[model samples]
Target chain A: MNTKIENKLTPVRIIAFIFVALWLVIAMFPFIWTLWGSFKVQADFFSKADWSNAIFGFHTEKQTGGFFTMDGYYGSWIEEEFWRAVINTSIVVFFTVLISLTFGTLGGYALARSTYRYAFWILMAGLIFRAMPHMTLISGYLQPFFAWNVWGILPTTIIVLVAINQPFTLWMLHSFFLNIPKDLDESAMCDGCNRFQAFRYVIIPIMWPGVITTGLFSFLLAYNDFTVTSMLLSDENETMIPAIASFLGTVQEEGKVMYAVAAVVSATAPLFFFVLFFQRQIVSGLTAGAVKG
Target chain B: MKHSTFLLFSLPSLSVMFLFIAIPIVSVFIQSLHIEHKQVIIVTENCDPFGCETTTAVDTEASAKLKEKAPLGKFNGFKTYSNRMHFAFDEVGEAWKSSDSFTVFTKKLYNYPLYRALSFTLTYTFVVTPFVLFLGFLVAVGVNNLPKMFKGPTIFASLLPMIVTPLVGSLILFWMVDGDGVIGATLQKIFNDNSLSLKASPVLTWIMLMVYGIWHLMPFSFIVFYAGLQTVPQETIEAATIDGASKFQRIRHVVIPHLMPLAIFITLILLMDNFRVFEPIIGFRAEAHATSISWLIWNHLRESAYPLYNAAGATSMVTIFGVAILLLPVLIRTWRDFKEKNKG
Candidate 1:
């Protein structure tokens, strides 16, 4: 904690500081640029005369009689009905997180508590499953889903996402559960409680920290997913990420790229707030697997 | 835990994985062996106009019936795997025989879609992983040197790129680098070439995507390495410094060795992630220049008029094989570690 040695104004320290400053600009600039540009007309945002027009919004002033306009937001949200995609995204993310956590906790608890050889094999299988590219899995599901008449619905996508989420959820929670003392559940069982009861009463009450951390990740996976949600959901049941993508295809010919821009910013706003509120949990969740290994 | 109890506890998770993950892989393998049925054709002769005229037309109803009867189409039995869109065994052989030099042969092979995709995927994975590790370490060390007050805000700023959805993140960058956008305009002005466009060239597009990859992934490695730095033993660092080591020497010897395991962990994760790169290509609209294996399969299913399930299935099977091959060394190492732990 000594400031003199660590914070000395040496040449190396100055260079490192400049590098970090450069990285911060690179990391933060694009989002700030997009968010700013979303308010302007395409002419101003993509301003041919000068890039500074995007900053000052000269064409936006000429067109809309102001420096800022909500035309893009209105076009995307109201005209294109982006709200439906937002609602669909909420439902899918909510249920996917809930169901994945439920199944993950049970399986992870069993894996952590058991001493069988099969436990090792199961974890290994989960590792392999975790590495499977999601698009490849979606390719596998399309034919069967179409044949069964379950291809383009919210529930089917939710269930499929939960299944896809299992391997990661199990690994994370299994490691988390290993950190919890075994005696808590065992001592409860010794007091004449059965296994499920011990889990419900003894383990459940004290498992929130790990569960919350795992749940944040599950929430992120469901929220940020593009492949599964885009391919599996019907056009009518589109989520935000897919809807934003589809907007480009339809709006490009109509000269409405700003609508797509607005939608992209809208979709990212929730995740921005998510990181703001849950930075610690997100950081810990990322390092949990690495640290344990 | 008792076997029965363990089964009871894990039943819901296991059943879903079994029904969804495990079975679909099997189904994908089976579907790869079959291609869509050819359309039924009917030929007729009309004898009214001085000479008989023969006409051929597709029998839609019969083809529909065929599709209805066998939803998986005709069983072509591994033909789909060898077709021009996939592994392209025939094309590879032709290219091998005709080309006089190795480079010429590879250039010919790169024209095939699968090989083209494989080249990009492997290059992106290997190229991005190392940069992520190196730059991420620098950022971690830099952040660690800052006074405690500025650390939280800096970390918050750093997390935004990684935390945002990949497609959206790429799109944000893509727009800025578009011909009329900020960075693109600035570059054109600097280079004095109004015709210059990032999207117009293959090499530039590849670099742009890889740069985006490094930007998006660096934060994850940074956070992990930052955590690793917290546990770097102060005693070792102090001893090295006291033994006439410079600050760089102390970091190079003591700090780097302590963080080596974390670096390996990050590399494994970054490889797995970067190999499956798909969303950024779409977001950047870079498919014209670079296509990944995931994007290739997705294109097969979604871009065509009807889903090319057979082509997609074949690609998926191949991709799964690729993943297995990529993971083989790590799996073997893990297995050895497990065995050693058990023996000990």
Candidate 2:
């Protein structure tokens, strides 16, 4: 594993390396471009007369003489109350990851330990449920929630998101839990620990990697969701993505596209940081299912 | 674990699954059968005072009473499902009956909501899935061949699009494709056309959306395939090379075979995910040019006044049906695998 393959350079290798380098630039350049544009004024960023204005910010007139301006950020965060959306998003992500992980850990442990027909059937049902678009379930939620007068609140939305996230959480954690030696649980039980205690002590310590991975995914699901939140949450409870979307309609109509651009940048910033820190978990979480399947 | 312990462990998730996922499916089916209450209008004519006038007013009291009596309105069975938005049975029949030419008939197909969405959804699913897989494989092989120093950064850069929120990702692309943005402006200058814009035409918009689709999904496939490539037995490659097989021959015969299961797994996931496409259309503001089944459902739910609950339900059911159809092949494959494992 330590020895590097010292193959002679061929034209094919050069071409491949060139393609990889080009793709790397293509993949990473847009975010940098947009993030830069978000710091400039509207006219300069989306200048019709000169494309260089986007980069140079020549049209932006602000006290900061440099090519960047904070006007778009100010307009979005201060005037548009994007902070409220940020708070809402944090609440949703916090609770969604917490609750889904709690429930998923228990269910996935049980499924992983069991050698029964029920576990198989349940996993199968989960596969089917995973395939159902979230919108289909929203109509069902609407009738009962509206009838009960609990439609648009944060708790209702959280509960629904938790429910929606459960199947994947369960599937992921189930496979992860399966990877641990069954003897670990068996010996813990044989030592006078009950099943719950065994899981609490013996399994919990070993399962953190899988749990954290699943939790990260749950957080991303809650954070990046536009469909369920946009549908279920009222105006006051809108998350960042949906709020940014709402801005696209009205703000863009008002010729304030920069507000939406700034908000988009703000919304994506956390994810960029999240990836920088937890890229390992994200990659593992993604490949886990495919490899298992 | 004992039965009681097992029940205690599984109860929370199972209940949530049943309450949210299972029951909602049945409710969606039932809801699609009944129509929402439409306003009863009353018109009257007065021939006195200033002049003869006609007025149209909503019979709110009667409508309210009707709503109270049957909150879900009348049970219309499958009527809503057959309407222009869901199955478009009537429109398809009429379009066939009325069109004098193939072009006219195909143009009329766009007028039917379900077919319009189905056409785009199918095209996007089929086109984007294969391209992503192929491009992902290419990138995976290329990156795998590179020095270890370059791999991490390349992988990191690639994952940004896949990780970003779909709506935000699409909007970033939308901004770039706008008339004034870098890509659009560069494209116009290259073509020497003053009137070129990505948002201006349907075909171009579709291509842009598909391109976004590939971009957004490419990293997932690339990562998965890259991981798969690492597990390819080096001995096989060595053997193929010893036989004087070219690099292409080695990959084609050995590496690809090893990666088949993973590729199929990615394909199944990509199909299911792509079939429910909704966010990009909204983000790109491409609804005027392209619609998906999910968008059709959301459109009904967000409609002014009555909100078309029944129609939305029907559309959701239709979408669910489409997803299930897409999933059938994958399900069969999984079932066969399970059966083979049990036999072994």
Indicate the TM-score of model 2: 0.96
Per-residue lDDT tens digits for candidate 1, residues A123-161, read 999989889999988988988788789988999999999
Query: How well is each residue in B223-282 modelled by candidate 1, as lDDT tens digits?
Result: 999999999999988888889999889889999999998998898888889989999999
* Model 2: residue A7 alpha-carbon error in angstroms: 7.4
What's the DockQ of model 1?
A: 0.81
Q: How much is the lDDT of residue A243 in candidate 1?
A: 97
Chain B TM-score against the true chain B, candidate 2: 0.94
What would the TM-scores of all predictions be? Answer: 0.98, 0.96
**Residue clash pairs of candidate 2:** none
lDDT of 2 by residue, B292-339 (tens): 888888888886665778888888888888888988888887789878
Question: Cα deviation of A185 in candidate 2 (Å)?
Answer: 0.7
Using Cα atoms, each model's DockQ against the true complex is 0.81, 0.74
Which model scores highest in lDDT? 1
